[model samples]
Target chain A: MELQFKSELTISESGFLFDHSTGLTYTLNSTGQFIFRKIQDKQNAMHILNFVMQEFDVSEETAHKDLDDFVRQLKEFDLVSR
Target chain B: MTEKKAYSKPTIIRHSVGVQNKFGRPPATVPINRLDGFEVSELAEKYGSPLFVLSVKALRDRYRDLKRAFSTRYPNFQIAYSYKTNYLKSVCSILKQEGAWAEVVSGFEYDIARNIEVPGNQIVFNGPYKSHEELTRAFNDGAIVNLDNYDEMQVVEKVASELGKTLEVGIRINMDLNDPPWHKFGFNVEAGHAFEAVKRAEAGGKLKVVGLHIHTGTYVDDVTIYSRAAQGLVNFYSYIQEQLGVKLKYWDLGGGYASHNTLHGAYLPAEQTCPTFDQYAEAICPILMSGPFQAQDAPKLFIEPGRAIIDEPFSLITSVVSQKRLPSGQRGVLLDSGMNIMSSVQWYRYNFQSAQDSGTMLEDTIVYGGLCMNIDVLQASSSIPPVRRGDLLVIPHVGAYNISQSWQFIYLRPAIIAIEDGEVYVIKKAETRDYVQGFEDVPGKFITN
Candidate 1:
């Protein structure tokens, strides 16, 4: 599925994310920032998983779990939509 | 070439309005690696996970410390280890070796004491329901039998008449102590029921009333209730002596002392709330010492301590089965242990410690047992260090009711090991399918094997 984030959502390099529609603020860890940056660049879940697995010394299962959990939280907060 | 950075789970913290102390400083995680100088992991490996590890040193020390606290203060004091708390034969044997007499409340427990060769004279049999056969056995064996009601008195009188011997008995009395009273087991002293029972027993002529017993409620954090119980029992003792002219030789202040395990709703840990053995002794001994009887004719002050003596010596070792994040944004971890084996979790917030020193990224976690039932939660709210699947967790202060009340529900009960002088001894073997189904009888038609 195409990973789509809110059009007006603002993100910073230091892992600060703010959604204009909900006015909710979030702080992400470095790994989470990398995934969100990929999502903001309109990357798909598969590409993001591959990027995380390649960038960090993580197994495919760990990278997949992290990507899924991050995406779930993003969807839970209405920051991302399919 | 540069190495790739280590991977940690990607995490996000949402900052919402009115959220105070969001992600507050994680509580320090002090892992419990060794118990009695034996590695918990090694013991778990040897005995299997979800095991019960008991410390013989702790058991003997707790019993001795409690006995010393009372005997040093009051010269005529005696301790009878209550059996219903943890009726493991090995546990009872240890206390027996420590010079404690057996205090049983049921026919089964009485049988256990007998099977352990605890002489009837050394057994203080106290409870409401004692069958005629049990009473006869106790009386014939010269056990200190405390009659609970008029019905029991009549039965005892009949037993004494049949034996053609006048049997000495103690009447269990209960008073309104303003702290949740245990009026179920004994005759009510406030309502004059105890006096009436004593008078009836005396007039019967077959039973001689020689003792008065009272048991306050269990896990009594307040020490003053003991003081009140002592004073009330003493007053009743004097009244019985003066009015009925019956001299009492025993005054049993039954066990309800709190252990180091925290109660469910307490704000502070039990170590801070529970009264010390010295405090309990101070609350009780002074009054009994200055009672209506002199030193030479002083009534034997008997205490039946089960929880305080047994609770701190045992620890439960469980392994994490799986982890999940619940809908409420809380961590949920499942363990091989459950309410079936650790039933005392209903009344206590038992401390769970990491068996290994995992990093200190403490998370708010809820621990569930392996049971399919929803009520199998071990800890409703806990702050624990990050533990992966198969990581060992040790729960201390579970030696009291966990074993005696443990049920062989869905999972077979685990083994119990006693660490004595740095050596491991298996007290109870893990329940196998054969052991669980040993007593079952299936119809031939229903069994298609």
Candidate 2:
């Protein structure tokens, strides 16, 4: 799976995301921002979960659990593609 | 290391330029997670999605507040609970326990009043569609029927003659107060229909005209309309008394009290625009007290308070079923409830809130009900935080017409529970598919097909 959006999209340092294709805007939380950047940097699901596990002091099992739910949500919101 | 962070669904919302930003109004993201110490999420889980949760506290408080607002100002007054607005047995029982007369508008509602054991004398039947049998029962049982038309006046007389008793009844009066006269339901006060109707009742001898009733319209926001409507009724009251030499026993300013629910396409929230109980009281009490009735002969001021007493108490808790992306790239969440059960959604832009906060990022969202119809949209457009399937949403101010008018269409209506001080009372059990189909019969031809 990979994070996908139109090439004209813009993500500010403060986590303000703009979908240039649809002209919609969104603000991401700290975790959302980190995940989005990692996705944009072509990180896989395991890599993203590892990063979350390391930074958020969560067990690998919890990180994997949350990452699956979070990615499913990203797919629902059209922020990523399977 | 720091603690693990919470999760919020990834969301995108269309940012539009509007005058709303210039007004600096309060943001619409109000979190209503718990009610009467019960978590809304748990309520949906326990009672299935699309649950209607009514608050016994809010109902009692509103009844107390409205009664206090009027009774403290005037001596002769009664708050009749309008049965058509919300005739949930427990809802009506609460008001009746608080000393309210049941004001019904149909034979069905009249029967409901009777089934609840409210005495015929304590019921005020006020509708245009009373059947002959219903009229006979009302006349025989001594229920006050507000005569809606001249034909109804004849029906009352016939019933009274059959019962061999002179029946006391109220005449339904309608007048133009800048708004269109609802001409179909009652005798027009301006066109002398009301006056002539009274004379006929007087000459007919079997009917005793006892009250002047006027229900101008519903969701009446302007407080002055009550004064204007009351003044019209009072003038007509004086005219009837002077010409026919009969004094009215009551002056019923019928129901249509506006609650704080913002209408769709409305510029301001209804709380800011809707008149308060005090405002309505201030407008009409002085006039009713000073109206043509002599100080010694003042009639009991009757108001069928329905929406005003019931609307604030209930909240509909529906769960998000699925999320679909709209053409505008906004999330359209389909909830487990829709316009079929939530008829008020077809009229007002109901306040929908997340059961719990997800993020500070408010997005444009469209809320739809679980119905398979195209017209089942709840809130066509609103700003709200992220929500996903199986999450909870709460819609408030639905205790009025929504329940009474709801019919089982495609889906069965949900359970309705009344909460009081952390206690739950099941006012209505959730409808089931078997229950919906139980009354239906398959014709022979249809069964063969």
Superposition error at B446 for model 1 (Å): 4.2
Cand 1, B chain, TM:
0.95
The reply for model 1, stretches above 4 Å from the true place, is: A1-58, A70-82, B3-28, B445-449
lDDT tens per residue, model 2, A1-82: 5555434568899878888777767667677778788888888887777777666655665456546655665665566786
DockQ of candidate 2 against the true complex: 0.23
Candidate 1 has a TM-score of 0.88
Pairs that clash in candidate 1: none
Chain B TM-score list for all models: 0.95, 0.95
lDDT (tens digit, per residue) of candidate 1 on B1-449: 56787676676667756523533322447899999999888888888989999999999999999999999898788999999999999998988898999999988999999999999899999988999999999988889999888888888989998999999999888999854667897789889898999999989889888998898988887899999999998788888889999898889999999999888877677767789999999999998887887887888989999999999999999999988877766678899988988999989987778888765445567999999999889999877876778889999899998899988898889999999887889999998999988999989889786
- Which lDDT tens digits does candidate 2 get at residues B153-266? 887788877888888888888898745656766788788888888888889889888888888788888888889997887788878878898788898999888998877777
In model 1, the Cα lDDT at residue B251 comes to 91
lDDT of 2 at B143: 80
